[model samples]
Target: MNSSATPVAVDMGSSSVRVTAGSFDGARLTLSEVARFPNEARTVAGRLVWPLHELVERTRAVLSAVADEGMSSVAVDSWGVDHVLVDASGHAVAHPASYRDARTRGIPDELARRGLTAQGLWSRTGIQPDPINTSHQLVATLRQLAPAERDDVARVLMVPDYVAHRLGAEPGWSRAICSTSGLAEPGGGRWADDLLRELAIPTEWFGDIAPERQVAGHFAGSSDVPVIRAGSHDTACAVHALPSAPGPRVFLSSGSWSLLGVETDRPLLDDAVRAAGFSNEVRTEGGIRLLRNLTGLWILQECVRQWTREGVPTTWAGLTRDAVNAPGATALLDPDDPVFQTPGDMPARVRDAVRRNGGRVPESPGEVARVVLDSLAVSYAGTVRQLANLTGANPSCVVAVGGGTRNDLLNQLTADACGLPVAAGAAEATSVGSLLAQLETLGEIGPNDRSAIVDASFDVRLYEPRASALAGLAPPNLERLS
Candidate 1:
């Protein structure tokens, strides 16, 4: 099999590294799987850190298989906000702690005491102030380290950059992902030293944030297989596949996490957005990504995992169907409740929450699954409305992407909940977006050509909202009004 006719893409996620190859015949690209490696996080010394060295090894091993199979070019991308600091020798100084670790607690307050208040930070950098941000983690880690070791650190490459470095290349600080760390100057592409200083972050913790689609570097060992930055941020890559063209549109990448927002020409950082939990992140072309951090499938996945462990098989499909058939809004949950923050005893917690909310605890697998899915869709509906109120951009439709899109129940719930059309498909939105950037980087396509390209390669699932289904959000004293 002569492999000269295909191209490939590499995607790094919080849990796995996947690569796919495709042939671009001037119109659309047809992709083939190259590899998937076991990638996950671990608790090291009580902190959750991604297995960095192991991740790189698996990524290279997977891509190398594609290299061996033959490919024209490769582009790399991953989840943003977590980084591994490499000494001048390009070796990680310490395991990169997981953003979910408890160590990040109070760092937000520490930044404020140091005079990096929410307003000050946003006015200076435009990033939303959140404890889970990399800046907070960097500060928390620095507090743990001896001051001497901090200054000697050479490169603070985000995870993707770290992997790229080991791939025998100069890692890039991509704009797409950098914006997520709450350190970048929001709509701006460059890192702001003044903001870092105010936040007390060392200059060495970050690199120049660049648009990955423009720069080219050779794969460390394979000169014939050069790699492009390709947006470098997984969420941005996911948004790249959303059906956004010629109108106000929102892309909701609902997976283990739910990213709900609209692409903006500028940052929306007013009191409205701030109060509603909306963040302004930068997109691939330096576009503003006004979204929120909504705890998504974690609840359902956790509950399902727990039930299965307890001898009850609860598939998402089975659960969602039960919810669709069950009574609507019998219980409402604070989906962002701190209890839901970390994993453990999700089913119990859900039962407790239902009991606490004056509702009966779910007694069966179907009831539990139904509650989880309905809650997620309701959360999405509420979030969509809030985003619109924050940015004043009432998007006509919601473009639902990623693995969560496969949930027809959740998709319909969102449609009925928000009373807006939902376009869901390309369960591989993140990878496809990654591949889209790869295609652009290879000069086989243009970025703005996304609409036609996506239409050709994907089957868009559209769900129209019925005025009658939105009654779920009200006081329940009334029926859904169209």
Candidate 2:
């Protein structure tokens, strides 16, 4: 295989697994999508868990196809926090629990009983004490295990690392994603040993944390190809893929979850940031991602899924089109409402939330979709403003990447609510960022010129706020309406 042939980038999201082969010549870069497979969680005994073996099979099939293309390197990235517990021989003790599982529903109260307050956690890890965090999930799992079963576990690997291990790569953890565990020291990538000691989680269970772009191993069949450590966390890779030059611009990686934040040279550990629900996850490029994880398109996705199950199928484009034309500000719900976190009866929940908040109950699918889009935009707008306020960043525009970029209505509403322009595109941002990391690690893309090259390689859609939408914000009930 030629050393210059582009690497294969595998991005495994909660909803889908996408594989792309990129060819980056000095002048231009061409990315071709090779394979895409739905990556759904299985309902095992009423608990949502990732089907690791099936996912591994699907990934191998994709990699096998790319092996014949003379590819010399592969980079894999996925959603953070969720991990698999394996024995010394690398067999999974149990299926990996999806973050949406309710096992950790009472973790916050449990931690509180142990005198581990949210302030203590936020100050130590710079992560919000969310039940979805790996630490909480690990504790929840341990509580259900027999003493013998717990002793059999030798190692834990995050989703992306586990996939790489199945592909013959050295099993390890990435600091960028480990920060999402709510166990890493703030501003530093080191695992928080004190907190781990408090929780009685042996540090050895987690392998050594490696920096991004480190070579893991080679594909099983393709011995010559290297498996590069991309930012294991999908959002970290997406942030790296931003086409803009390094500046104080708000980066919104919207997908199943809308992670809105600012990139700063340092982590924001102030009381205000913590109170505002901001997290400081480690960035791949030695920075900090001061962001908040908002309940993104998941609520709307669940509604669509439920509707399809009931024989009323619709696509995202159709939903967005209907939402764009629906009357604005008629209904609204906070995207972070806990009731909408789990799957099932999403439309009913949305209606319930709206009515509880003193808004009209949406009766139609389009109206429900509008409520979701408008609420999401308002969430984005509020987060953007908070980012500027807390970090003293004066961002001129918001840069949105990932699948949510296709939602033009959401983007425009965000602009209207935040009073800032939005530049959105690069739907396959995590893959692009993973590819860039692989290329940069291989010395193909110079550090000094990387941002410029990415900017030239991709396109951006500009959205400016509409006055009508902004005017609707004056009403207390329709603050997110614009």
Candidate 3:
């Protein structure tokens, strides 16, 4: 690797794709955004599908631009589950379906009707059953595809892997990202052969799972720049960037979805863990991240979207200020309510949920936002307690990372609700982690040096718990809420 080489991280988020370039000055890493593009799935022929060609073109343009700026190595990470199917010639068979598509609406139930019970599947994969999982999506996809169209499918790659494959990497599945698909075995060792056999999915579509931090191939147009596998799952990449600490680590990768979990040496497959709504995913550094995937800021985002469409656009600062000044919430919501899952009149659905739960309905946007935030805080606390019970490790502090860390009110509320201090930072954690992995692979940095680099590179805000805020509130029963 050149001493002046710059490594890049491509973070493919559900809402946007960000390309960040990193410069390591021996002791610390400095990052800058080189490109950002809106990434949204659209309705095509009455089905929701990702704009695969457009995304690839934009990404290639950005990577080519960075190549001209002395790029070294690059890696890509994205949300998991959704995948792309390609023919023998590596051409995509069709646009990848969005995880939010309605095709998977009753696939889980359908699987159960076919004698594959949730418990049976969980025991095999150690993944929480969800309609959006790749297993369910594949089922829905096969059911809708003509037999000839299905036969043309020679390979299936997770979104990140597909992107990397298009960029000249030898076709392969990164282990960290593969774990997100319920079709993989625990810790992403291999495909669950028995499960796939029962699901009737062709085993040929999958290949060997590749470990992270290894060079896959060179950039398509630039042989000097290696495309590395730096943790393909976005959450795994974010967790990789966390400052190394000694005790039990509880992290909240807050974003559109809030993933609350702790790292463990192995998957926790107990029925209690499954009943508690937790799933075990593989980590970039080897091990399992036992987490509860809860609905996070999406509710608030939906509320804001509704307001904007109603000719009453609201800014984040103004909404937060108003929420802070508004009266305390008289009603609390289960943010994971299915009614709030899809786009539409979110505010109305929130009110309906409150009313159905026998609580006072919130009429104003500020009040509604307050309820959502408070409810999330309570849910976080409950999940923390559940973690303690499930793992028997006392968490030292709550480390909040990603976009939601910027919300000071929610951070403080989380601290209070959990009765623990909160350390928030690394808003671009996915990029940071990806950069670290790239540098390590290039021999510019070592594993033990990541903590020092993170400490030098970012500012961490600490929020102390305010015991008074927990006076009358209890961590809502998460099991009941779901």
lDDT of each: 0.74, 0.84, 0.87
lDDT tens digits, residue span 37-100, model 1: 7666778888888887877777777777777867677777777678887788888888888877
Poorest 10 consecutive residues of model 2 by lDDT? 473-482
lDDT per residue for candidate 2 within 331-376, as digits (tens), equals 6688787888988999999998888887778888888999888888
Q: Report the Cα lDDT for candidate 3.
A: 0.87
Q: lDDT ranking from best to worst?
A: 3, 2, 1
Q: Which stretches of candidate 3 lie over 4 Å from their true place?
A: 1-3, 468-482
Worst 10 residues of 3 by lDDT: 473-482
Clashing pairs in 2: none
Q: How many pairs collide in each candidate, listed in order?
A: 2, 0, 0
Better of 1 and 3 by TM-score: 3
* Per-model root-mean-square deviation over C-alphas: 3.5, 2.5, 1.9
Model 2 lDDT, residue 219, Cα: 89
lDDT of 1: 0.74
Comparing 1 and 3 on lDDT, the stronger one: 3
